[model samples]
Target: MARFTDDNDADAEIRALGEALAMLRRERGLSQAEAGQRLGMTSQGWGLYEAGKRSGLFRPDVQRRLTGALDATPEDLALLVRASSTPSALTQPFKPDGLEMRGRIFEGAPSVERRRLQLSSDELAPWAAAGTVLEYVPGRWPRRDQGCVIEMADGSLRARLYVRSDEVELVVRGAGALLTIEKIPRVQARAVSAVVARLDEG
Candidate 1:
């Protein structure tokens, strides 16, 4: 059996969000096929979004791709969330110009709450190519072989493969080189995020 929320407003919001997404697509003069291509999805998949299928559209990872693909802003997405009956982070005040909050962009809009890393080098080629935009969740621990962004005490950033971790250091392999990054109790790197997805576009 299909599940439906007891709240009547929630149902309406889902329909509204889907409709709003379709409207946004049309305003951008994008056909479903074109929009799908930009978001790394097929035309048929894109159509599902416009059909009022999903009752919610605030998924952080999914929104990152959608906004980035359509060149839309957080404020633009917030407008759609207003019609949603459920509480959402998108309903909060946000600047379309990309504001930062706690190392997050757009005031942590669910669609854009994650940190973004554009690969500067093919140091992790075959998995993450140069020019790839990696979206990750902060404070998310990564397991062995997972792609991650590590912050160092010296304020340096590195994209590496998580090999193993300990209280003292984290073993990583990048660019075919094995590296050990020492941790500083308070100032050193203890921050790591697992790469959830990669978006590559010119």
Candidate 2:
């Protein structure tokens, strides 16, 4: 892994801000669609933004929305822009196969605490795609009724997990304030999980 040094502190700051946005989205336990709804965008739009695909463009309004959605301070987005434009010695480790890395994309390596997830269905589509990246952190579960990722006997779903009188209710979010819940069989609702962060190209 490459090191972030003081000489390139400005660029480091920019990269860190992107990482922070990735973290906030995961912590909220929201799919891209859900997150987009909050930001007045479609899930696909949010996906493009999060994927770091919209570089070399400036949209103040979108930036403001993103800042609010990500809980970032006012100037944080500016720093991200600067870092995105700056060239630094730090680069994504090159694969020996000689293939080129993607351009204008985020490039952070994965840490032990982070693991990637791919959406498998349109059941959560618009909020998450059929193959979207979700980062999971394994540790202290969030409060009951909070969003979670669970692998039960039936299958896996990203829903809010609440414990009722001897039962675990998995609640799924729907479009336009709609929500659904199912009583998960103890045998099936095993291996419940929580999201901690998201992995991006950077």
Candidate 3:
């Protein structure tokens, strides 16, 4: 009976840890296959960790490697487990600093509008590859070095990295066979939306 109880406790801890890892991966908008690719492993291998079948997940070195691939720390995984068990933490909506807004982009317009575009070229390269889907929020100003989708007044669209903008022009970088800088007149750009997320297809 004592041995059986000890096994049950170990299983419960493993399951809790796995749940935390899955939550972190989903929060980063990564699929199991995509997350596995970061660690040079197959999706099934990654799934084993999330299914609590992989005992190596309890190792300190393995924890670091797995969490680092997700751009997180092992401490974050532990905290997430604790937070998940708290009822109030689950009820509160996440609001990052400097993101609060009160007004719509335009009269009769929604407070936020998201649009998706599929990349047909590798112009964005390592930042975003060909066949990756970009989710952008229109009317939101992009920060420097962020990805953006630009709509030209002439009905053409471009995906590039945001550099800076002045009264005269908007400057951006294009990553292709070679890096190129482009400056478009402010008057010619109909809209510049910030890319919020990149979804890579498996």
Candidate 4:
């Protein structure tokens, strides 16, 4: 009886972790296939982890590798699980600017507006090649070295790697031997969206 109880507890924990992982991936605007591609794995392999069928997920190193691929930490997963269990956290009505809410029936679902773009030039090459499709989330800030798409006031879209930003200017890197800095003034950019995944054509 004791052994059965222990097995049930472990199963429950694994399921909770899987749910957190799925939530984090969705929050980053990545589908299972996209997330799997980042880790050089198939979507089915990644799905096993979320289905609580991959026992290796309990390993510390495995947890780090899986979560790191999502740009999240193991600690973040734990916190998410705890927060999800709290009723107030689910009922919170906070909504971010420039984000459109969907699936109103499902409370606490991430309010993300994902956009797609195809590269027409090698300006962001090696990191992203021409013909590559990029999935980006609008209103999400990009971390250093991450890809970003800047929408100009004139309706042109510029794809570059994020370098840094200030109140006045946003610094980005274009294709070059040197890490060239292309600065765009805040007023010129209508929106700066983070590129979450790059899908290269076969």
Best by TM-score: 4
lDDT of each residue in 101-144, candidate 2, tens digit only: 65565565454464566655544444444565666655535444
RMSD of each: 12.7, 12.1, 9.6, 8.9
Question: What lDDT tens digits, residue by residue, belong to model 1 across residues 49-122?
Answer: 66756543546566566766766664576576663533555445534477644444344344535778898887
Error of 1 at 149 (Å): 0.5
Query: Candidate 4 — worst ten consecutive residues by lDDT sum?
Result: 102-111
Instruction: Please give the TM-score that candidate 1 achieves against the real structure.
Output: 0.42
lDDT of 4 at 9: 79
Please give, for residues 1-202, the per-residue lDDT of candidate 4 as tens digits.
2454578878988888888888877666467876888899998999999988887887889889889988999998887877766658666654559886655644566656888899888777666678998888888898777788899999999888899999999999985645478989999999999887777777
lDDT at position 38, candidate 4: 83
Per-model TM values vs. the true structure: 0.42, 0.40, 0.50, 0.58
Cα lDDT, model 3, residue 92: 50
From the highest TM-score down, the ranking of the candidates is 4, 3, 1, 2
Candidate 3 residue spans exceeding 4 A from truth? 1-111
Candidate 1 residue-pair clash tally: 0
Each model's lDDT comes to 0.65, 0.54, 0.81, 0.82
What's the C-alpha lDDT at position 100 in model 4? 63
Candidates 1 and 2 compared: the better one by lDDT is 1
Residue pairs with backbone overlap in model 1? none
